[model samples]
Target: MIELTRDADVAMITLRRPERRNALDIEHCDALREAVEGATADGVRAMVVTGEGTSFCAGADLDGVYGEAFRESLYAALRATLDTPVPVIAAVNGPAIGAGTQLAIACDLRIASDTAVFGVPTARNGLAVDVWTMRRLVELAGGAAARRIMLSGELFDAGQARHYGLCDRAGDVVAAEEWATELASLAPLALAYNKLVLNSPDAGVEDDRLSAAFDACWASSDIEEARAARQEKRAPLFRGR
Candidate 1:
């Protein structure tokens, strides 16, 4: 249901169920969460998420799984992506609908292919995106764009997506993969800290948490290792603490 490949510092996670247009089922969602968590734990500095065939992800597997359990599993996969320390890049190769769109939005960056389209068609099925999911859309594309997409259950093409700031870049998969690798090559501490700060709440609530995270880096052996690696003219191996 999921294929995980490690390329240097980047882990490529692909949804392999093309037979169903890569519709997310319980097993597929579970596998995705596990793969993402495993990559983070294994010192992967970044990840690229894409689908195997023409469709990046077509949303929930209505024929395979539905109801509360399915929704919970989908939520878990998205939350895991958010919780990971390293960056997760969504390489949308095709249409991303419903839960599919949710997964892409959860990622730190979305790199869509020229052939890709993004749609949140939950309204078509009489479903509502959860609170956090709706907020994420608002955060990415702002309130007006979010309303236009969600309320109308409209599908936006790659160009429209770019206009709305839904995708950072739209290009070939190879290019997207290379971009992900470049991101993975950056300093792990800086990458994690940047993501933490970007997703943190207002200064009033984030000061303590941000300070603690920064302090942890200062206290970590990885900091010393980074210095030594720099002096030695080699890459630093960071063990996330």
Candidate 2:
């Protein structure tokens, strides 16, 4: 199940099936996407994804791990995180194995608690993640580390993940939400543009949309607010214009 709540302008999405260590089944995956979408629709500036209880997520529930339905729903949930206009942070509190790892990597940033562990045991299960997931893993964790996770089913603790750049910080959900709260104070349009360009880095040399976004940021009134605030020695109040 998915439980969504809010902290000021930051949305919190928690995976709540502690009974199975919050493992993803088809229904849970669908609910996750819905929670993300609903929060986005409500105009949150940032979001934090986490799991309930001690475990972040064990893996895909073994009963549905071998089925096509599970795969589709799983990727759909991941895509919801990827496609959100605002940034999402993963608060990994414990073992994020298999699909759990995919979910964590899908977020813009990750904060792994000291008790957290990350791994993809696909090879052990005789299964494989999608090309996009693999590429994203390589992008965030680098190729060698990605290979170690996939090929050897190696689990990295919070410290190791931070060393490998997989986890941006080592802390619990509180730290993740604190970061998101800080992010909420920034200019939304600029953050959205950054996310856009980062997600589609090779949007072509002559990409008009990219150029437009760049120009928009420059032209936004938030820039003026920033200038005035700087002159006054105060933080800019960005209106997302």
Best by lDDT: 2
- TM-score of each predicted structure versus truth: 0.89, 0.96
Candidate 2 weakest ten by summed lDDT = 201-210
| Clashing residue pairs in candidate 1 (N, C-alpha, C atoms within 3 angstroms) | none
Which ranges of candidate 1 are over 4 A from the true structure? Answer: 202-208, 219-241
Candidate 1 on 192-224: residue-level lDDT in tens? 877888876455545876787787778778878
**Against the unseen true structure, what C-alpha lDDT does each candidate score?**
0.85, 0.92
CA displacement after TM-score superposition, residue 174 of candidate 2 (Å): 0.7
Q: What is the lDDT of candidate 1?
A: 0.85
lDDT of 2 by residue, 139-200 (tens): 99999999999899899999889999999988899999999999999998899889878988
Q: Against the true structure, whose TM-score is highest?
A: 2
